[model samples]
Each structure stands twice: as C-alpha cells, then as structure tokens.
Target chain A: MTPPSRFDEPWQAQLFALTVAMSEAGHFTWARWAEAFGATLKAMGTDRLLDGGADYYAAWLTTLEGLLDRSGHAPVDEAAATKAAWERAYLATPHGQPVQLPG
Target chain B: MRRPFGRCILDSGFGAPHDAPMPHDHPDHPHSLLPSDPALRVKALETILVRKGLVDPAAMDEILDTYERKVGPHLGAKVVARAWSDPAFRDRLLADATAAIAELGISGRQGEHVVAVENTPDTHNMVVCTLCSCYPWPLLGIPPAWYKSDAYRARAVREPRKVLAEFGVSLPDGQKVRVWDSTAEVRYLVVPMRPEGSEGLDEAALSDLVSRDSMIGTGLAGASK
Candidate 1:
C-alpha cells in the first residue's frame, strides 16, 4: 500500500500552517486553539466514518473560523462574505483557469 | 467554544449549520481542475487576514515548507536509536523528555512537554490523543490520519490490545498493555524494545530499523533492513 502524504490535500497544509502562523503571531495562543479544536471535536462526536477526511478538516475549519471571530482577527461574517465572493468568482471562471477574486 | 450544530447564537449570517457536510468533494468540478470548497475558504480567510495586517502569507509559506521538508518521522527515529545506544540519554529521555530531546536539537510546538515511555519485556506502551490529535510534531512531524481518527481515539484506551492487533501487533498475554492518552499540554513517544541480535549494528543502522509506528507504539521495530 502507498504511504499517506504529510497532508491529504493542499488545503489541509494551508489550514494547518495558517493556524500555526496565527497562533505564533499572537492572534490566539496555541492552548486556546487546542481548546477550541477539542471542543469542536467533542461536538462532532466520534461515531463518524471519517478519519481525518473531509469531515475532520471540516471540523478544523469550523474551529478556526470560530476562534478568529471570537478574537476579532477576522469575523465569521466577513469570512463568509469573502468566501461567497470566491465561490461566485470560481464558478464564473472557465475550467483550467485560476479562480481570481473580483477586484 | 462549542459551536451549536444547527445555528450558533453568534451566527455570521452564513445560515448553514456549522457542522453541515462540506462541499469539498463537489463532483461537478474535477478534483484536479478546481480547488475544493475548503481550499477556497482558506484562500478567502488568508486574503482577509492578509488585508487586515494580521497574517503574513510569506511566513505561512515558510512554516509549510518546514513541516513539509525539514521535519518528519526520521527525526523521531534518530531519538529512538540514540536511546537504544546510550543509557544516559534514555534515562534522561524517560525522566524529562522535553529537555533531553532539546539536547538532540529537536524541540518545537506540540512538543514542549513530552514523556518517553519505554517498552520492556513485561510491558508495552501505546499512545492516543482522545481529545484531539496531540502528538510530538517536532520529532514525528505530522501525525498519520489514522492517529487522528475517531476509531483510534475511542478504541485505543478501551481495548488497547484489540486495537494493536488490528494494526498487526499481537503481544503475548504475559505482557501488559499500557495506553497513554496525550493532551495539548503533554505528548508521548514510545521507545520500542531493541530488537534481538542487533548489538553489532551502529546507531544509524539501528535508526533505520525504527519506523514511525514503532515510536508511536503501534508497531515493532524492524529486525533488519
């Protein structure tokens, strides 16, 4: 069997690094991030078929968004709006093209 | 920070439940052609944080490079081999793992508090982070997906031998199985018993026998290359 990559996806690496960088930058302490992540894990429950799959990372994203919102670094609403803009921009961009956010 | 599943009191008008199934695997967009939902979401967050002067993309890139290239299980293997070769280092590792590991130039986040559990003839030690996937990232780098799985978190502490059997590790009945539950505050590294008939081998050769799972206590070290 093939070995698993350090991260399953590029996005996973991005999320992981962003969390570390933010914590190092003092947006939130690693302990606080751990607390938030643990709470998210508890809320998600341990009965799912997911094992560090999309569902797991979904929980991670949820925790990150929540932490940023609470810390006033990036409110959830603003992130959501920006995400929506990205979705619209991506859907409009043709296949095989980089999805650029509207200026 | 418990996020209520349906809608949070602090809803940001996104409307969807916080735990709603992610559209990261959307079928319409080919996996190779388009970025997944999570990727786009990350991009959005990074863009916003960068604009707000709260995050530096370059710094994030450097961190990613470090994890991807500079850190991994080999580092943990070096520690294990050293412990196998040097009794004083092994004692120091067991007594105060964080400081001992620092002596080897291996210390970083998620590894500030480490405890080395050595396997003996009568005992075997395994580790799991039931809360979250807390692991020694400085030595072991990113944890395997299975290490963070709900199945492992729920079962490793309940029936450790059974879980170990699933990983192809079946200990003798006389050997007691001890499972360690790691936390954000403390992580664990399992130093597997030195394989028999390897006294002639050098430290580097011994290190090659030490696999990632051996350090995590899920597998035995290889007898030879």
Candidate 2:
C-alpha cells in the first residue's frame, strides 16, 4: 500500500525541500540544520498535545528563519517584509484577478 | 519583464550567480499570488532565495521529488528481505549496517549511519528520535505522524511495552523490549525476524511481508499465507 503523504500540506513539503536543497548546495551543513531543528523543538516545549504536526512545522519555519539570519543570507526582517509585501499585493488585487506587485 | 539579475542587488554569501529577479518585483504579466497564509510565507522565502541565487526552484523541485517518490520504506524492506534470506548478508548487516545498506545503493542524509538491530524470540527493538523527528528518511520514507508526536517521543523510551501494546503488539513476559534513541548522526532500523512458514519464499516475495511498522518495531511481519 502507498504510504500516507509525508507532509500534511504542500507548504510543509516545499519547506522541507528548500531546506534540504540549500543545505546540499553547501550553504550550510546538514548537521547544523539538525542541531538547530533539535534546539527549536526543545524551545517549542511539549506543553501542547499533538496537533497533527502543525507545531512541529511551525518550529521548522522558525528554525529556518534563524538559520537564514545567522548565515547573512536572508535577514529575518527582510523575509518578514517580503511576506508582508506579498500579503499587501494579493490584498490589492481584484476578485478573480491575478495579483502583481508594483514594478 | 523579469530582470536577468541585479534586482535585489545584494551579494549573496554563497557567491553563486543569481538565478532571477524576485517573482513580485517585475510582474510583467498578471500572476496570481496565493492568499496570505503559511504557504505564502514559504513562497516568500523561496522568492528571496531565488533572487539571492542561494537556491533555484528547479533544485527544490528535484529534492521534493526525491523524498516524495524515490526514497521510502520499500527500499528498507528490500534490505530486510536480503538479510533474512542470506545469512552472510545478515551477519554483515548486523556487523556494519551503514556499509551493508550502502551496498544496496541506499545511503544519504539521516541514513548515513544505520544500525540494524535484530529482533529475536527473546529481544524486541523499537526506534525513536526523542530530540525531534530524526528518522531514516532514505530507508523509511517520512515518519508517521505518531512517531513525531510528543506522546510517542516522550513515552516510547519510558514505557516501550505500553506503547507497543497500544500498537496491538503484546509481548510475552520473557521477551525484552529495547528502545533505540535515534540521533542526527545515527539511526536504527529494526530487522524483525522472518515470520514462520515463510522459509521457502524468495527475497522478492519475503519483502512483501515487511511492513513499515515491522521495520520500526511497532508491528511484526505478516504471516505467510
């Protein structure tokens, strides 16, 4: 039988892919990623019960943000601003219209 | 119109040539942006990296395909089947799991170092990564949701018998349960004993009986019909 989807959603798999790709490209070692991920899991704590790995992926995103910040690749503020820009651009688009950022 | 380069204008530390300008910066045509959500955040990250030349979308697609399709438990089942049918291979697997697994052209990431613990009539083995969801992705695809759950990670080591019982695996009083804690450097794959009445089966047929849970030590191989 086919195994269940490894990731709950498409974004989770995308994040997983990006992280592994970047690491493989020599941006950072896999060990470093594992270490930060483990540390992130610890800081996330075990207070809440399982929520189908939402919390786990949240921690993964947080760890990626930190790694990017430390590597001087993409500062946290830059990523946040980019996300905000996308948020605004999409909001400005009309219903049934494609969203495009101002050039 | 997408700018070839020199859009973000930052010297990415990687020193690789930039792939393209940010997806949103140019907007030559009307492109739909996903609603502002968690997925959009990931898209935003991808956009930034693409602009910086740290990663490209094609590479991301390839990596995603590798994990999603090419790698998984069936590979591990093949190894388990070989170990069961060939005594010499079994000894080599127990003696040096990493090399033996690599012999089957399966070695990468979390599976770089593997230890194949044998489950005998006396001892049972289970694997857990208490730190996070560190799993042998190259062997057993992605871990099940429960493996990454807090309850399993916290309780598996402390109460293996109880957890096994919940999985419908009740052991005899004389059987010893051994829980192996997986780490980034090393992972454990349980080599469950071949089921009885499966002696005449070939490796290909025997592999059909190796469930993902059986390799993880949560369940046993199905009895041969």
Candidate 3:
C-alpha cells in the first residue's frame, strides 16, 4: 500500500503513525505482544479489569509505549505529539473536506 | 419530561379503546405499535438528570449530536471502499475477515474476529447482535441507536425479509435471506456488490457509493443509473 498521506485526518494519521512506529519498533509482532500482555495480566491479577482481553491489549499498548520510549528510536511522547499536531490541524480545517497532503 | 407522559396519556385517552386502527396493522407504518418512543424516553431520562442538576442539557445535546454525526459512517465508508477497490482483499475479507481487516490497519477495542458475508442473486445477508449490539467496529465503526435497540435485534433475525423490506430493501422472492447472528466473539459486515454503471470509477468515487446501512446489510449500495 502507498504510504499514508501526511495530510491524513487526525484519527487516520494517528492510526498510520502508530502502525508504522509499532512495526518499526517490532512491537507489532504477535509473539512480543502476547508475552508482554501475558506478563502484565499476571502481575496486575486480571481481575482488576472488566474485560480480560481488552485489558490485556490496553496493557500491551502501555508496554509498547514504554518499550519505544526506552529504545530511543521514536519516543512514546513523540507519538502523542504527532497525534496532537494532527488534531490541531483537523480542528483548524473545515469539516466534510479532505485534508490536503504536503508534498 | 412531563410532556411525553402527558402526551402518552392524551394519546391513550385514559385507556379508552378508540375506533382508530392500531399502528401495527397499518401497512404504511414502518415501526411497530410500541408504547414508548426510544428517543423521547432517552430525552425524558436526560431531563430528569438535568432537573436533578446531574448533567447539563447542553452537554447532553452535544454528546448526542457528536455521536449522530461523527462516529458511525466514517468507519462504515472505509470498509465499503476497501471492499469495492480490492477483490483479492475482499476474498480474504470473506474468508478470514478479522485478520484480513487488521491487515488494512483498522482494528481495535471491541473489534476482533470480523466476518464479511456477500449477498448474491440466490442469497441475501443481514446481521444482528441478539444479546447486545456487538458490531464490527474496525469496519463499520459504532452501531447506530436503532441497531442497539432490543426491538431491532429480536425482530431482525426472526423476520429477516420483513425487517429488510421495512428498511426499503426487498430481495427477489427466490433469493434466500440469511440472517447472521452477531455475538461478542464474532461480528459481521455485509460486503455489498459494486453497483451497476460504477465499473470505471476511481476508489474515492466508489467509496462514495457505499452507505452505512449497506455496510450493515440493512440496505444495498445504490446503483448508479
């Protein structure tokens, strides 16, 4: 698939960036995710969360953020920053119109 | 808050039976003769909360308005677009939808194990979450208010063709209507066929042809004339 447009809407851009960042950091790998999530569930005693699977994935995303932070490739904060930038751009643009991608 | 109850009492005329035909028996009426109007009921509940100083009226209106506009169609269009543009991808979507959809970079909370079923000349497909509104969020986004209603869920599967007809979608008599029951484990999206005269359209144009109801299998994609 073609690279996601830089001008993608806030949610679209965030999704694109998260996918790319996680893939690059190897956090998207099922093995890594399963291990991290399993460990988190074990530590947190799964009972604390309402939906076991949802909670596991939420914990997995948290773990991924931390891992990306430690690796220094692209810090977790950078993800939030990117998302915020997109959100601001989206708010500024009119509704029902596609955001123009930068060349 | 008080108006609906007053109206209900006025309409009911203090339990006096009238000669006016019941709504359920009326051929033109789209909905059943249920005593309660869901929207009005919700408004009544919110009015109570507002009266008790729990939630502000403006806040409630804003929340409801945002939900009505933003959340559902955005995701539904994307799924329809993807299906129209990619046949190989569509095949995979029909085969093992959950994993296939995730490949397209759209899966998360309450969205896993999605299945896309096709409607053909001989068969038509519709979906309902019997227990609750378990929708394929990765594709169709949030389930609409009507989708979450017990009236819809209970009746949809039981009278598939009838429900579809009420939605203004009638399949040919020979066509077999297959109602897929959605559960917490697996949700379904209807992969409607590309409309006629839409053969040479680009992806964006094609996406425009897909409606939220079509993706949910309540209606078909409009044919280009």
Candidate 4:
C-alpha cells in the first residue's frame, strides 16, 4: 500500500515507501507468516510460545526472511536494494539519517 | 579478526602493532576466529570460568544474565549525558554524527559512521534493520534481543504506529512516523529533543531525561508535569 499523502515528514515517507515495496514483494503476507510462526513456536516449547503471543508471530516473519537469506533462498541483492533506498532518504534529512518524530 | 584468547588480552590492553604474531597462520588472516554469535562466546567463556572454579558456575551465569541488560542502557545514558551538556557538540552531531561522536573518543570497529537523527515537532523518526541487525555499537553497545528479532523488523516497517503503541508511544492521527533501516554501510541513532522541564538542569540531570527507548524513537524524552 502506498502510504497516505498525509505523511508530511521525510522519514514517514521513507517508511511508507519501504513498507509498500516489501508488501509488493510478497514479504508481508499474513497467512504465510502465521503458518511459519506457528511451526517455529511449536518447536520452541509451549511455555515459551505462550509468552510470545501475537508479537512473537510478527517477529517470526522477519526471522523467516533472515533465515531465507542465510539459506540462499532470498537474494542478497534485495537487502542491498532496501539499504540503498533507506540511505537515499536518510541523507536528505537534517539529522543526516532517517529518524521518527516524537509525539 | 581471529586472535588467540591470549593475544586478544594483550592486544585489547597494550601491545605493539608488530609485536604480536599474525592473528592467522596464513599470510592473510582475513577472518577473526572469535565466534560472532554472542551467546556462543558467552557459553565458551562460561565453560572456562567453571573449569577454573572462578566463583560458582551459577554466579557467572547470573553475571551474564544481568550483563546483557545493563550494557546498552549504560552506554546510552553516557551519550545522552554528553549531548545535554554541549549544545555546540549536539549541533555538530546533528550535522555530521560520525565525527561528532568521535570527538567524545567513542569510535571503533562497530561504529565507523554513526549518524544521529533528531525528532522534532514536525517529524517523528524510528529505526529498524530490515536486512540484518546493524546498530551503533559505540553509543548503544549492542542491539537488544527484540531489535534483532524478525517480527520487529517486519512489523516496524509495516505498522510502526501499532508497534510504537506496544511501547506506550502513540502519535496523533495526523502525525507522521518515519522509520529508518540500518545496514553495515550506514548506521543510525535517534537524537530526541531536550524536554521542556530540563531548561535549568545540568548535564547529569538532563541525561536522566533520556532513555534507551527515546534514543530508539520508541519513547519520548522525559517531560516534567
């Protein structure tokens, strides 16, 4: 999803851009994420699983991607691309890196 | 980067550049032997401590247990303390972070080009490592377990407002939330603004206003009621 036009801040725009890219790349599917996370948690033990709850499942997708990269399933070039996009946005900011606005 | 345990001791403290033998037997010792995995290294050290009867194994374990939590916040507190005391330095930091941090003599292998991002009234910034966990080691010591976790990486970019809510930070409906993903080439740190009540406070008191979460952009600087 392209982030809402209301994202006035530079960092917000960058994050919106990144999320859109990753989602388009099929990395943000909730179904695939839930399945993989459920299996991993089953192996980690029940008590540990209980502690993790929903947040654990969310983190698992990121872990799955890393594991895919490590195992050569995901291309290293993709990561490089994401890094490049972030750098471009970061350099434009006054702080010289992308940062979040405080409430 | 691989050095014998003995050589690591000597080199870590005081040793001539050419005095120690080459870290690797080969002509080019490209990779250091130290395990990159923090848990494995801790385990290896724990075994040595146990064999030597240096306190009980449980005592060493306890140290490792607490050691992980203490290191990051301690380093963060120091950075915030320095920033609060020096406005010129803080300006320099906002301009060219790597050099500004080096001014405090806190640069090394892991913190080559550390950048500091400031959050202001108009903007909010958050950081993530979508690929691998790249962090500012000199200022923050090490990335936390949650930081390295995959869920945080994905959700942070996808639904940052939701994630921040988990940390008890919520932006207004119209406010924008920006997230930066760090890599080996470029690393980032959040420089939260000085709080309102901190006007007359000294460096130490001001530093108390900064928290690890604030530096991560997951929390706000301390606000006096």
- Writing each residue's lDDT as its tens digit, candidate 4 over A49-76 gives 2233333333443445444455444434
Report every candidate's CA lDDT: 0.79, 0.78, 0.54, 0.52
Q: Candidate 3: lDDT of B188? A: 85
> Model 2 over residues B1-225: C-alpha lDDT tens digits?
222321222212222334543334434534333442676677678778988999977887677667877888889999999999999999999999999988999887632588899999999999998888778888888888889888898889999999999998999999999999988888889999889899899999999999999999999887321
Model 3 has how many clashing residue pairs? 0
Top of the candidates by lDDT: 1
Which pairs in model 1 have colliding backbones?
Answer: none
Count clashing residue pairs in model 2. Answer: 0
Q: Tell me the TM-score of each prediction against the true structure.
A: 0.84, 0.84, 0.48, 0.49
State the lDDT of candidate 3 residue by residue for B131-201, as single tens digits.
54567755665465567554576688888888988888878899998888876557788877678888888
Root-mean-square deviation per candidate: 8.8, 7.1, 19.7, 19.8
Tens digit of lDDT per residue, candidate 1, span B1-225? 222211111212212325432334535754224356787778778878988988887778678767877889899999999999999999999999999989999887642598899999999999998888889898889888898888898899998999999989999999999999887778899999999888989999999999899888999998332
By summed lDDT, which 10 consecutive residues of candidate 4 chain A come out lowest?
A94-103
Quick one: best DockQ, which candidate? 2
Decreasing lDDT order of the candidates? 1, 2, 3, 4
